[model samples]
Target: MKTIIRNVHKSFGDTKVLHDISLEIEDHEFVVLIGPSGCGKTTLLKIVAGFIPPTDGIVEMDNHVVATSSKSVPPNKRNLSMVFQNFALWPHYDVRKQLLFPLNHHRYISKEIRGSKKERIDEVLEMVGLSEYKHRYPHELSGGQKQRVALARAIAAQPGLMLMDEPLSSLDAHLKQEIRNEIKKISLNVKSSFLYVTHDQSEALSLADKIVVMNKGRIEQVGTPEEIYNFPENPFVARFVGKHNLLNGMWHDDVFVVDGVRWRKDNVSEAFKQKGMIPLRPDELKIVGRGFGNGSGAGLGDGFGGSVEGLPGVINSVYFQGNQYELNVDTKYGELKLFEPLGKWQVGDKVLVGQR
Candidate 1:
């Protein structure tokens, strides 16, 4: 059940889409391909799924060549199941028929197995919590329910590999989160190798066993969620994966100087030093009172009550993020985004920004 993609490249006329992309998905592992729009995540997925042939590369499943530059195995021939962004269920078929269609027509299922199709369908429907809606049509179900049906249908096929292309994108925010969890649970329960594609980093972080971050048709980095978020390999990945306050600066004499303001550098990699960009997450930066002395400015208690050590800045704007206040501060180098617990500071108020 291991899948390997080696030196995969794709081009459309004069435009090149994928560039030397290579990755491996282990058995039963959940791997997510995430990046901005048109970054070739979907293109690479199609290549592995046998929908298209790579210009120069080989895609192997368990040492068998499924696709290569010379030829490609057809999609239906591959023992793979795909769940699309749009619930690609038949409009005329009920949930039961939709779940049973694949089993009825699949060549892999023998006559002996065909007799248990109803039991298998029941098991999958129960896995996705759609047993009660087995008789309903696609139009009669809600967005989440339809997605669950789609998932149940895919699981019922019991393919070794599951390819999900933005399967939860069409749902609303709450439903998206709910279905995202369901997808994770289903993957764990079914133990199928999942290659999911999405632009949402949150989905990647929350769902994937390994995340492949792509940019401009090339992979930027691949690692666990903590590694991608805490120690990004490049500037693009640092900014793309999370809410980062990027400070453009030069590093010399073991110090980072930005707009004539110097700060002691820590937790920065040597590679990032060459790139001249420092990324600090939103939770890393904190807000304190304006003045140095007690009672001289807003008498904010605790950390803000005493003298704070940080770079000087003015609050430019404040945005409410439900749990915390996101403050956009105008610093000497550039604008920095930080979060605060209280919304007491107004625009144009001078403040100090420090890392936690």
Candidate 2:
């Protein structure tokens, strides 16, 4: 199904929440809406699901208007399925009953179909790798298993579009990773359009064919994972999507200067002149042993060579992050965080920071 949202706005009392939000979900594409809490991602999803009417604009499915400012098609009639953060399973019903509940309620299977309801239930259970636990109740399964049942229930409905809201937030790290992969595979096998909502950047980056980053109830940027991460449209996206060391400086004569240090600037537009924030990822900056041109002869000689120069800073703190050490250094501008792959540096150590 192709979903289109155009100029959708929502407000409650006097507070405005979504602002002229427009996006399109292509057929069988997995699109993710990502933002912080209270950013109106869920509100937008609900609008698409026909749970509420928008304050303005319209939503369409396959070029057919399903919702507008005054009217909306009921959620059940939209031929779409939803999986919520909570499993929303029936505690009294067993796994088979839960999986068959949607199919039975909607009368999706006809009498002329070759397979019975139990057979169809078993098929979805096997798809989710929960066939052995078909007879188990909700209380009998683990958290991950219960979530799998929720996903299975939604899939069994055979909706053209599926909406998921943070379906794996409750699981542990390992289980979250496992289910994320499962969701990717399931989407491929089902060949249905998926509209997912989450605040986790990693999930959006890993799962989405297209990512929509939201902030303050507005669509900040929309692009593929690589485009959004590498070329953020603005400062908020640059700061929110990944770990970055933002440096405030002035652009002058094709150079960006900060704290008496100069770096060559490239591809900056003319609109940015007096001041702007330069975002540098962790890998872009490195720590060196000696200051640039200080002549102290205290160089670390870790293959940095002479291509890169150093910026002066003192180590503020050090954190052990398994493979590498995350060091917070206090520079003239502000506190900058960088990753150190080797060597041990203590707090209050005056070190030279450089860009690779």
Computed on alpha carbons, the lDDT of every model, listed in order, comes to: 0.84, 0.83
| Candidate 2 C-alpha lDDT tens digits along 1-356 | 79999999999978999999999999999999999999999999999988988999999997889999999998877868889899999999999989877877753334532257777788889999998998999989999999999999998867778999999999999999999999999999985799999999899999999999999899988999988887676777877886677787777777777665666656543333434667676767878554333232223343456543456678879999888999998876778888988677788887778776
Global lDDT for candidate 1? 0.84
List TM-scores for all candidates, in order.
0.91, 0.89
The most accurate candidate by lDDT is 1
Query: Which candidate wins on TM-score?
Result: 1
Candidate 1, residue 99: Cα displacement in angstroms equals 1.1
Q: After superposition, how far is residue 208 of candidate 2 from its true place, in Å?
A: 0.6
True-structure RMSD, every candidate: 3.7, 3.5
Runs of candidate 1 exceeding 4 Å displacement: 107-115, 250-267, 291-306
Worst 10 residues of 2 by lDDT: 291-300
Candidate 1 residue lDDT tens string, 188-216: 88757999999998999999999999999
Query: What local lDDT score does residue 268 receive in model 2, on the 0 to 100 scale?
Result: 44
